[model samples]
Target: MNKVQSDFLSLLENHRSIRHFLDKKIPDFDIRRIITAAQSVSTSSNGQAFSIINVTDQEMKKKLANYAGSQKQVEDCSNFLVFCADLFRLEQISQRLNVEMKKVLDSTEMFLIATIDATLVAQNTVVAAESLGYGIVYTGGIRNNPEKVSELLNLPYRTFPVFGICIGYPDPNRIPEKKPRLPLGAVFYQNEYPNFDEVYPYINKYDETMKEYYRNRSESKREDTWSKTITDKRKIPRRMNMKSFLEEQGYPLK
Candidate 1:
């Protein structure tokens, strides 16, 4: 990689999901730039099927905080945003242009396209926020009650809240330790995917690294390893009703 590319990557490698925030707030100009960066992300067939709702109303944010795993960060952060898969917006456009709807919003590929668009927008927004010295936390708990999130936002059909983001200045005294990740070999395959046997050694190495990380990365250290954590979490189903939720949101997802 070039020097600039390497430096940018070094920045990305230091990313952490900050849950606590200082009393400081993000500047309005920076917020606009961050969103502009999000808008710059590529979309499938230029579908641009994503929407973001900034939640600044105190009472509403608190209600959302309650729904999102009761994470105080939702209300505590300088800014909170919900990214949504928004085929409804495109559907409106198609109507204005006198287009048919049957093959557009009802197909499984259409759902995938919209969801992917929302994800890319959020990911780019993260990069932009980090570049501006802001800390961000992505709340998967937004899905803990998707129906509530949608209802609260008054989102139309063909729209789904993918996740919420909390953004603010990081508390100096509350900086979190960076968590370890799986080693490159196990995840960064080349021309072909490796079999389980070939990946076992890298898994063992990563497990050892994560064991050390969890033990020393915090004041209240825990006993855990990468492989063990994966094994434990993999067996449990999460968001099992997500399929039904999508269907209810007007994505037949067929």
Candidate 2:
């Protein structure tokens, strides 16, 4: 294969989330370079409505670990970063320019742009961290209690926590297995989404593959096929209240 194709295949085939981490600390220069790479991502309209808070304090990491669904990686990892979607900077700019901030903050389109900006930045950080030999995990559970996370991080109005990322050296003793993904044909469609008639067979095979993967990799032997996992999560209504939580956090979503 060509070099680009070889690297792309390596990246796709080897990507795995590492939760168990060694006690070693990552150096400050590497952290700075990784974050610089993250900041190099293209932002929406160059607004750059995102910021990352590096949490190095042990006490704060402990508290954040609790905030993020009691995930031990939050405390055990060498570094923790809270990625935030921030409109507050633009609001400040508006004040300095004597322009109205209300119009920008109230628009749903602006909110989406800010969210996209944050997500892009976080993903860039993940890739950069991985390339530098650091293992990383994205903690979506940071939003399990948005208010609590905001309070812990001292987030100002118009800035919301998008997610937390933990980065560190992986513990050699606890090597994680590479998780399987759906076949490319299952997700890719020409010009439109594939109909169920064209997709269900692939999904069924994928479900079996996932089941076998879980059986081998997990000690708990969780009977979570892809479809069953999706059904189980959707059946629970708790994650649906995220809209109200976002509104409460000053998104306004108008």
Candidate 3:
């Protein structure tokens, strides 16, 4: 295989979210370089409609730890960052350039672009951290209390926390295992989506494999198969009022 292909496969094969961290600190220069790598990602329209808040305060980290399902990584990690979908910068630029902020921020296209930019940068940060032998975890639970996070961060209108990330040296005692993924054929298709006839059998096999994996890995605490887990999750109502939350954050979703 080509070097690029080999490296990609290695990264994919070994990927896991690290929740346990050593108590050592990462150097500030290394932190800057990691964020620089994240900033190198291709941005939508070169607008770069995203920002990251570097959070290092112990008290704030403890609060965020509580907010993020009591995930220990939040308080134990060397660094925490919140990636934001931001139109606030664009608004400032429009004001400085004597253009209308309304012309840019009042579009569904702009909102989509901002969200994509934030997600892309966050992924890049994770990859960069992994390459540097650092453990990292994404905290989607930041959105669980979006208003509270916004208030804590003093975020202005037109900017919202997309997610948080924790980074640190990996703790040897709690090394995570690679989680299984669905077979490539089950997800990727030639052009149109593959029919159920071609996909269902693979899913069934995968479900059985996953059940065994969960029983072994999680000590049977989670007995349900992947399909059952998804079904159960969907049966319960999620914090589905995100549109109202966005509106509160001044994103009208126009």
Candidate 4:
């Protein structure tokens, strides 16, 4: 590979979710640099329908941590960014121009667009932060009590917290080994989707790889295959109120 390709791939392959952070604060300039890099990423229809709330206040972070299933990383990181899929700004623009957007805003497609936009921006933010030598972990636990989190952050209508990212300097002693990923053959395809019989081999191979991974992990070591782990996780329904919550938040998704 060329130097640029090799360097970028190296950065991506080295990623591991860091839940432990040092007490040092990230510089303001570095924060701005990370956000700027994130903003430069592509947005759907050039709408840029997303907002990021950077929480640094200790008290606020503490409350957020509790709301996010007591994820201490939210409170301990130098910065906790809540990425919101936003349509409120679009509503404002419509009001200013004397146009109607209520119907459009209620469409499921629009909701998907905003959510995808926010996710894209957040991924870019991760890349930027990691490039600057910062450790980061994404917290989907924020969705456990999205309403409470929204209240704490004072979020307006037509917006929802998709997830939060905890970014800060890593505590070297706390870093863990990177988890294994499924084989590319299982996930990648040519044109048509492959038969299950063909895919099962790849899945079985990955299951063994993950079984080993969990067996040797430093903390919370467990003996489990990836398939079993995922089945156990998904068999139980979670966040069943999300649809109702989204409707209440002005994303009726009609």
On lDDT, the leading prediction is 4
Clashing pairs in 1: none
Top candidate on TM-score is 4
Candidate 2 pairs with clashing backbones? none
Which residue pairs show backbone clashes in model 4? none
Regions more than 4 Å wrong, model 4 = none
- List the global CA lDDT of all models: 0.90, 0.88, 0.87, 0.96
Q: lDDT per residue, candidate 2, 147-203, as tens digits? A: 888988899988899999999999877767888888777998889997779988889
Instruction: Mark the 10 consecutive residues where model 2 has the least summed lDDT.
Output: 215-224
Quick one: how many clashes does candidate 3 have?
0
lDDT of 3 at 82: 94
RMSD of 2: 1.6
Winner on lDDT between 1 and 2 is: 1
lDDT of 4 by residue, 1-254 (tens): 89999989999999999999999999989999999989999999899999999999999999999998989999999999999999999999999999999999999999999999999999999999999999999999999999999998999999999999999999999998988899999999889998989999999999999999999999998999999999999999999999999999999989
Worst 10 residues of 1 by lDDT: 213-222
TM-score of 2: 0.94
Model 1: residues with Cα > 4 Å off, grouped in runs: 1-3
Write one digit per residue (lDDT tens) for candidate 3, span 1-254.
Answer: 99999997797579788888999899989889999988999998788999999998989989888877788789999999999999999898888999877855867788899999999999998888888899898998888888888999999989999999999999988886677888887898898987789998788878987887777783234676788877987898766877899988868878
Model 3 Cα shift for residue 220 (angstroms): 6.6
